[model samples]
Target chain A: MTAVADAGLDLRQIEQFLYREARYADEHDYDAWEALWTDDALYWVPAGDDAADPRSQVSVIYDNRNRIATRLKQLRTGKRYSQSPPSNLRRVISNVEILGTEGSDTVVGANFVLVESRTRGMEIWAGRVTYKLRVVDGEIRLAYKKVSLVNKDQPLPTLAFLI
Target chain B: MDCVTATVPQAGTDRPDYSALIQPERVHGSLYTDPRIFAEELERIWYRTWVYVGHESEVPQPGDYVRKNIGPQDLVMTRDREGQVHLLVNRCAHRANLVCEDERGNSNSFRCPYHGWTFRNNGELLGYPYHQGYGGRGKLNLGMATVPRVESYRGFVFGSFAEDGPTLTEHLGAAAGEIDRLCRLSPEGEVELNAGWLKHRTRANWKLLAENETDGYHPQFVHGSIFSVTGSPIGALYSEKSTAVTRDLGNGHSENDLRPEFRRHGEPMRWFGTTPDRVPDYVAKMRQAYGDEAEQILVEGAPHVMIFPNLFIAEIQVFVIQPLSVDECVQHSTAVQLKGAPELNRRMISQSIGSVGPAGMLLADDTEMYERNQVGAEQLRPEWLEIRRGMHRERVDERGLRVGTATDETGMRGFWSHYKTLMEDDK
Candidate 1:
């Protein structure tokens, strides 16, 4: 719970932002969740962990701003039967660390365990997430985010909803 | 010598009558849920037939190899010292422990983790830690067992356990033409599958996924949401009035050939709905190589065809279905990489990322339907799943191929009949 004096951001404020962002995703609030991203937003969930180059290898979900909007648009359609009946979702975020910064962006890392309940069954997903946050207009905006699942190397079930 | 022909069952042996279970217009539901039938299919079809291994491009240089499975068998496809590729059982000759553990790598010999026994990439017994223990080795000559027949067509490799059964070409039969059509897309007449596989697992029979791969009848209904949102012209290709037709390529191989519909538009790169201006270099190279046929190749695009028990060239991706058990199956797929056309490959990669895997806009919806379908198939009331759609309109073409409308059950009939032929052969 140490405050980050270098980036001029405290631990409480950053943790609050992360929790709110997660809550938006958990509630399927596509508009609010999507608005958190900057115009240069990069949302990635790399396949088989976050080591390989995305240009040569493949990914589960790799959206660079425009693709992110298209993904949200598809979810908003309601016709996305995979999420027609959204899964009941909840998550616990922990182990937040400030891993330094790049330019105005603050590089932060955290771990989470999400639970999704649906007609198929209850699914528990554990992953490590890295986020690059930048303050624009005195508000925190997500510049880059990547989720690395423990089982990213293995066969996965349908992940139609936002991670 | 005819692999397609059915062999008679010898007298006094207990053999299930597959004909009664697989009818002309419908199939019994028990075939999906029966554990006994699943076991039989492993022995009769998967293990004995020509199962797809991996593409040669995957193991381009000597010592490069990839791990794969043909049914329940554990295998390693290795490129040996002589630049020859061999499909070897991953077990060590001495202890039966796996020799190759990596999903893919470059190795000239694999040493067993359990014992010190080593094997050459070509399945030869190299040596062990102590040779004198079991009588000093003159030459054990008893290397790891190899798959009986390994063959390749246009760099696509396939392996067979049965040495006496159908040759790979004989098994491919009419399906080979579609493969040629796919390869001809490359200016060098080649396709590389270097992109790693994305696997999607479901609690359903493998046959169900195989049936749905080329099942044009269900896309409009199963994937309507995607069509509604994307408004892709490929959606129209699946409609009833579209010129595209389904073909029964025999030996259970079939296609929802959308060439005629794309050709009707007379547009270049219409498959991806992109113009020549966007991909001037790809179009230019393709034009220079094939001349007049380039237009047809551009429009025809990737094939939506399923090759018998395990393989599929599902438009932008290549799929291999692996049946885990009666109620479990996993599908492995990779985006098609058109060699020498970096521009086209890049687009296919991003387009495919959104289109098929577990999180795909298209496949995710279909997967939900498949899971729901599996739950329904478990119900006891309905003993049969009907395949009688468009039966009256289906007719045999001049080439003795059964042709039907885009949304017919003709492809399914082709699959099950050959399934019956294989299951009934008893030998």
Candidate 2:
């Protein structure tokens, strides 16, 4: 691990990649969203404020690559009742920063406010996201994505769509 | 503010008789919406019957306590010195302010924030800040009042506000077998609730959750995506006529029995998140503990048991439904872990989370349906919601319990019958 100067990384490009990822997920572009992740990706949304060990504490979403793939397949089938009429989602990702680098992976952090509209009503979902990004074949791919919801500690409503 | 104020129905309004609302084959929509009926239910059913408060494990040590609500009453379930469990009214004996507002904690005594009235963990009044001010003027018997009846069966504690009624065992009836089976699954013949729980609120009537727990028809539609993804045999097993059955276990308790052959062998497949690789090891451990009987204990499918009024033992999770209002309820789901099986417990926790919580694939759909059903029930056009799916096919078994096919409404009918009796009771 080495401390990298901000000037050394393409912040705009990274933000663009993050924005595209959010857009793909919002639009239910399953294949495109799936392609953005590495084969060994970890998608997680911890249940509480403090980061929790998924193996020990309960998590909202703690899926490995295989489980994520399975979930995508289910959503693609157009029969997932929770998301049959997919949530209308729009996210504003801000506070993007390059924390450092771990070997070939770049650590990035950002704050997100996602507005989701569904049958029941519209809800505002705010969260912090930490990503472990690795450049594979000159394209950035997500090795890990961790979401810490603002209201994670409280009893939550249905979160059918990906945050 | 007085917390123990009684809710008196408005005068001159004809209180709709529940007997007219709940027929054998159908129930009126007002059963899910009327505030007066809801208030009556709290008084008649919830207070009179044994409502589950908390598991003993939640307050295992002396001084440990958890706040619980039964109907409209707020209570604190505590384990005092000498290991006796007590359910005390949360309101202070003085001005009726809440003594303990936190969800749960360990405390020697509860000190009321307003007016400094204090009570011991066992609910004995310790003292007030300025007790001399009373000065033999007013007879202040300020000890916190315990619920009239509190009893525990196999570590599950229940309380009744009524002074007299059926014993906890008599009330549990055949449903006691469900709790026993859950306990016997553990090698130590004990289950613990040390792991954290998930709480979710649904915009639906509390009764809807009870009915949905044993409703076999909705899973195919509501949870189809989960089945499609996990490739679980639940979809097929539920559809097979000979495999799945819903039984009115009597006294309003009902169970949806899945995979009867496996259940008969005692190797029920109800363990959530059980992968093929984990099965051999888990089954081996069970064999090591219970010998040949382990096959039945370890491999049997978990039956979804709905104990009337509040508790639902859904295989890997214990769900308690709390009614907040006529059309709102909160569901608390605690993952069940076997006392000695760490690996199996881990799988159970994972599976419980997978199928429940806000992000759960199955529960999210069910919650949506509950809300939709509540909204639909508000419409006056369809005054009745039918519960006659398998009425013609229902039959009484040798045990005198009513039984029907998996997709039948036998369980709902049983529930409504008991509900009508309780609601119509003059006592």
Candidate 3:
């Protein structure tokens, strides 16, 4: 990895990256989403307000490489319990802020409100998302993506999609 | 609908005469939907029993408190500086304001937001902010208000609102053996709650859930969607598996042991421990520490035990079903991690939480059935819930335990037999 002055992490680049990622997900291009992560990427959706560590608390989606692969297989499986009829979701990401840096991990924070609907009804899930990105091969790769849902402790209807 | 007309023989030293109330094949529908019945249930049943509260591990440190609801009351289970647990009513003595607003946390002391009434972790009153206003008294009203009676058995904490309620051990008779068996799986013979609970609010009466949990008949039909996905079905998921074995624990407690056919083969599919890695280091080590038969039986998931009323415990976790009202219920799920198990084994047990927690695939399926049942039962006739699957095989023994087919409604009948006793009390 080469160091450079202002690696284009300004508002435009970050905004474009998020918009492109969301568009790719909407188009069902999971390959593009997979490419955004490093080989040892970590994806975590925390169970509550605090996510200082995933080891102590319950997490909605805690994925290492192996777990991510298993989850992706389940999503595509025809018999996934919650997705028998499939669910539609739209994630609105906003209020992006750069929360300084931690060694090699560049911490970025944002707010997200995901609107999901299925045969049940519509539910609005709001949360704070933190992305720890690492610069690799002149591209930003996700080291970790953590989301703290507002109603994490509540008994939700289901999680049929990747929000 | 009042208690006057509902009066029946009281449960006594002699066997209860439920002949008029409970029939071998059917029971009066009043037991299911009546508010008068539910109120009497609160008085003579749930209050008299040793209802389980939060696990001791939830409040591990001093000044740590977690809010919980035991039957109809809200309580706070706290651990003081000496690492002793206390279950106190959440309401403040003055104006009855709840002391701890957050679900769980560690604090120096609990101070009422309305007034400045403060209390120590052990539930002792500290002092009020404006003490001089009350007759210029020094440390006036510093004594603590009455707290609920608290007790613990195998890290499971329980509270009794009434002074004369049965002791925790006495209330948990035969079920006590089940709890002890679960704790013994850990090398230290203890387990701890790792984190805050996973809570779910469902639009269904709480009693329905308590019955459904031990009723071995509903899983094949109700959880069909979950089974359709996760894995293959177990042999016990058939209608023919309805042999119900009911154990009678005196003092209003009973256990429904479903003798599903697979149990005879020493392999209950629901009881199988599916670890991410089949050859777990702990299992191997446990084989070395404790012999093969001990390892096989303990490791293999078998019996599902539900303590009478609302304390639901099984091999892996403990769930407390708190009824918010007649039409609403909230379930708190806590996963118990064995103390000396290998790290991955603990993680595997924790992963089992995924199958039961708020986002649990299996729970999502079961909840739909409960919601549908609640809504449908309200509209349909009560007899529609006729639980007479294996009515002819019931045999009452010397222990007062009833034996029947596993898939039979005998377990449910056993529960209602106790339920009828409670409902008939005040009525």
Give the candidate number with the greatest lDDT. Answer: 1
Pairs of residues clashing in candidate 1: none
TM-score of chain A, predicted model 3, versus the true chain A, to 2 decimals: 0.84
lDDT of 2: 0.81
Across B1-427, the per-residue lDDT of candidate 1 in tens digits comes to 1122122222355655677678788777777887878899999998888988788888999999888888668899999878888999988888688888888889898888888788888888888877787688745777999998999988889998888788889999999998898888899899989877888877788888988887887777767777776776767888888888998899999999898888888788888779989999999999999999898889878788899889999877898888889888878888888889999887787877878788888888888887887888777655678888878999998879898899888899899989999998868
Q: B31-146 in candidate 2: lDDT tens per residue?
A: 88888888888888887888988889989889999888796588999998889999999999989888898878999799999988888988888887765687742346779989
- What overall lDDT goes with each candidate model? 0.84, 0.81, 0.64
RMSD of 3: 6.2
DockQ of each: 0.62, 0.55, 0.22
* Candidate 3 chain A weakest ten by summed lDDT: A1-10
TM-score for each prediction?
0.95, 0.90, 0.78
Candidate 2, true inter-chain contacts retained: 0.56
* Model 3 residue B225 distance off true place after TM-score fit, in angstroms: 4.5
Residue range with the least summed lDDT across 10 consecutive positions in model 1 chain A: A1-10
**Deviation from native of the Cα of residue B98 in model 2, angstroms:** 3.3
Model 1 bad stretches (over 4 Å): A1-7, B1-15
Q: What does candidate 1's lDDT look like per residue over A46-116, in tens digits?
A: 88636777766678887889888877787887878889898888988899998988999988899999998
Q: Flag regions of model 3 displaced more than 4 Å.
A: A1-43, A64-91, A97-108, A116-122, A131-144, A153-161, B1-48, B81-83, B105-109, B136-147, B222-303, B381-383, B394-400
List, residue by residue over B1-427, the lDDT tens digit for candidate 3: 2232333334563433445446656654435455655665577666665677878878888888887777768778888888888877777766788787888899868889989788886767777777677655344555334345788888888777667656778777767877776765665667777655667666677777777766666666655544554554442444463443544444434455543333554542234434425635655555555675554444344346667778876546567888766666777775567677756344644465456654565565566666666666565344335657666766776766665555656667667666665545642
Per-residue lDDT tens digits for candidate 3, residues A83-113, read: 5455676788899888878777778888988
Q: After superposition, how far is residue A38 of candidate 1 from its true place, in Å?
A: 1.4
Docking class of 3: incorrect
Q: Which scores better on TM-score, 2 or 3?
A: 2
